[model samples]
Target: MTITVGEIKYTNAFPFFYYVDRNKLLEKDCHFLIQTPATLNREMKAGRIQVGPISSFAYAENVDEFVLMPNLSVSANGPVGSIFLYTKRPLEELEGSRIALTTTSATSVHLLKILLKQYVEVNVTYDEMDPSFDEMMQDHDGCLLIGDEAIVTSWREEVETYRYDLGELWKEYTGTSMTFAVFAVRKDAIARQRAILEELYTAFVLSKEKNRKEQYASMIRHIQKGMGGTTAFWNHYFSNLVYDFHTQQQKGLLLFYEKAYEEGFLPKPIESIKIWGDVRTHHSSLM
Candidate 1:
């Protein structure tokens, strides 16, 4: 069975996926489609794609339909310099002001809301808009930016603004990492094509391990061209990102879901995150 997989085109994901694409790690039966996080989320929900690295909010929204690909995610412990909130004034000072949330993001937007409500305790209004710094700052007191655009803006020396990394902010508030995205497969796809899905998962894990070398930095910088910032900046950006869904990352993700739920961002709280295949079987046995 040929399975369609979605990949997001972002520097944060370049390390894990760059080698996968360059080496053609996916088997002939696997197909890849590239798009933004929001597009991939919509495609996966609509059954147009079987598996994808979707926003954490997307998974929270449809938990029963998706099983996370074990040991693979995009997370950050602190200061994930990419997902930023460029503001006219300090976060606490933005009370009752309008914030322009990026329409391209689902998770970051929710994280921002959680931060403001749970941590900052500031009353504000939000509206979705295109992620242009100038346009966002023109009318809104702050703007949420994610992926490559956020990274570029974060490193801009000319743009002196209050930059708050949502991941860093989440860490400060919860003292845990923030999981932005995770590779997940539809429940129907896993039930129907278990073997193929296992193969794909194994391939993905192997691809990540194979490219753990420092030399991959040059390749990553090449892929992230025109996103601004120096190679070191890109390297550090990717370095802060974690791909494994270990205990710490899992705790962080669940806390995010909990906070989002308390803030009225999530419709309901998720009990256990479903994992694809027998990846968690041994761990489950120990427990």
Candidate 2:
């Protein structure tokens, strides 16, 4: 049976799929469904796709239905240039003010809430809406943007806005890395197509390595054909966006879930993160 995969169609997730497309590994055996993170989150929950990189917050809520892909994630150590909070005033001064958040983000919304509540100690009202800075700022004091939009907006120096990087904020608050997204597969999908899933996992690891070796420059140039931002900006942006769920990232993810649980962002308690297979021993090529 063919494996259907849901992929986040953004620059942050490009590294994971770049090598797969370059090598044509899934040309016949795989089907890809690409969309924004929010759409993929909803579709995955509806059982429309077998696997995808989902928001860390989404994984915590669906722990029983999903298991994570080992050693793969969209994370950042300190300043992730992709997730930002653009505001007219400082974060501390935004108490009781209105903040428009990107509806496309699952983790960022909760991250912002945690920062505002626990760190900033402010009581600001938040509304989730489309990620348009102009429209969002028209009615709100601040707005959160994730992925490509946030990257693009941060470069707009003439917008007269203060850009707060959520990843930086989380690190400052918790002193650990932040994992925005995690690769996850539905539990039943794993049970039914274990071999195919293993192959895909290998492909993912290989793609991540290809990205680290600077082989993705050509692919990034191709995607930049019509996109904003210069090649240098894109290069630096992707460089800061990391892709491994190692010890530090794993700790960050669990800490995020714990904070979310304490802050009531997650409805249930998450004792530990789950993995699909033994990542360390399952790196052999399945091609």
Candidate 3:
């Protein structure tokens, strides 16, 4: 049977999937379906897609049913291009203001709450608003945005904003690389199709290297269009956005889950969840 995969449309997340599709690396029986991050999580939770990359929070939210694959993710140590908090007031002032949240990003919403509670020392009201940053900025003191929207809006001059980089904050608090997203498979899929999944993961790793050199220009072009930035901006952002999946990064993932649980953001302990794939199977020099 063909395996449907859900993924985000942005360049940072698409290169690996694009490599697989462009090379036709999967088995004849397997096929992939690409969708937005939100749609991907919805489909995975509903069991429509067997495997795909998704937000770290989504994986935590549905931890029991999925297995994390090795060697592929969208993450960074200090600055992740996709997730941001834009505010007219400094983050410290958010203590008493109403904040508009971009409902599209589960990870960012939780990150904002976690950071605010830790730093701002007061609870703030959260209301969902249209994903448009302008509209959100008008009615609320600040806005949370992710994916291409954050990238495009970060360069705006009129928004008198103080940017809160969540990835950086995560690193400061945890002292490890933050995992913004990960490639994961359903638990049943891992049990039934372990061999194919392994091959797919290997292919994905090789493809990432290949694309880094052979398709960098195309990737930059895509980012420029999707993110509304110049080639230089895309180049800088892509270079800074680390994609390596390693044990060191896993420490951050585990830490995020651990803290989220302790802070009551997660419903249960992370140890109870089954992460798909064996980390020992893959080794990376980058970590």
Candidate 4:
């Protein structure tokens, strides 16, 4: 059966997904949908895409309909250079200031809220606006941005602002990796395409291993060409990102869910992550 898969259109996902085309078997069975995490989340929920990396918050919103893929995610231990809050005032000093959040985000928006309210203990108003740094900074004290836009903004020399990497901040607050997005599959689709899913997992792992073995200088050059970052910047960004959803990443995501739940961002508290994998191991993990 042909399975629909959502591919996150960001530099962080390249190591996990870039080499999928090398697997001829998967290329035939998988139909890929490339889009931003927010768009992918909506598509996955609508059943337009059977499996893909989606916003962690979106997974919680439709927890019953989906199960997470094993050993696959978009996460970082510290200083994920792609997500930043460029602020006018110092972070602690912005108690009553206004911040603009990117409307294109799902997980980062809630992550920022959890940090600002539960950790920072700030009483601030947030505006949901388009991801335009110049426009956002004009009217608000800070702007929470993610993906390529955040990276480009950080690289730009002209617009100087105090920038805080959300991943680093999350690590400081929780002492664990921040899992921004996860591979989520429709429960029904999992039952129908179990073999394909397993192969897909193998291919993804192989892709990640290959990426880690070398600098992939050509890929870096391509990224620099399109994104306008220095070769060193792109190299460091890719080298440090964590893509596997092991124990640490899982713990971080669970804590995030807990915080999101307490803040009333989710309808219910998620106790354990439901996963798509070996039945015995999945049950054991839940326990």
Clashes of each: 0, 0, 2, 0
lDDT of each: 0.80, 0.85, 0.74, 0.84
- lDDT for 38 (candidate 1): 91
Residues 66-157, candidate 3: write the lDDT tens digits: 87776678889877877888887877667778889986776678777877886456678899876899899888888888887887787778
Report the candidate with higher lDDT, 3 versus 4.
Answer: 4
lDDT of 4 at 202: 66
> How would you encode candidate 4's per-residue C-alpha lDDT over 115-175 as one tens digit per residue?
9898888889999999999999998999999998898787778987899999999999989
The lDDT leader among the candidates is: 2
Worst 10 residues of 4 by lDDT: 278-287
Span of ten consecutive residues with least summed lDDT in model 1: 278-287
- Per-residue error at 277 for model 2, in Å? 2.3
Flag the better candidate by TM-score, 2 or 4: 2
Stretches of model 2 off by over 4 angstroms after superposition: 22-29, 278-287
CA-RMSD of model 2:
2.2
lDDT of 1: 0.80
lDDT of 2 by residue, 1-287 (tens): 77778889788898887767523546547788888888888888988888989888889989999999988999999989889998889988998999999989899999999889999999999898998999999989999999888877777777998889999999999999999999999998876777767777888888788778975687688778857667788778777877988899989889888889999878987888898765333653433
lDDT score, residue 171, model 1? 87
Q: Candidate 3 at residue 74, lDDT?
A: 85
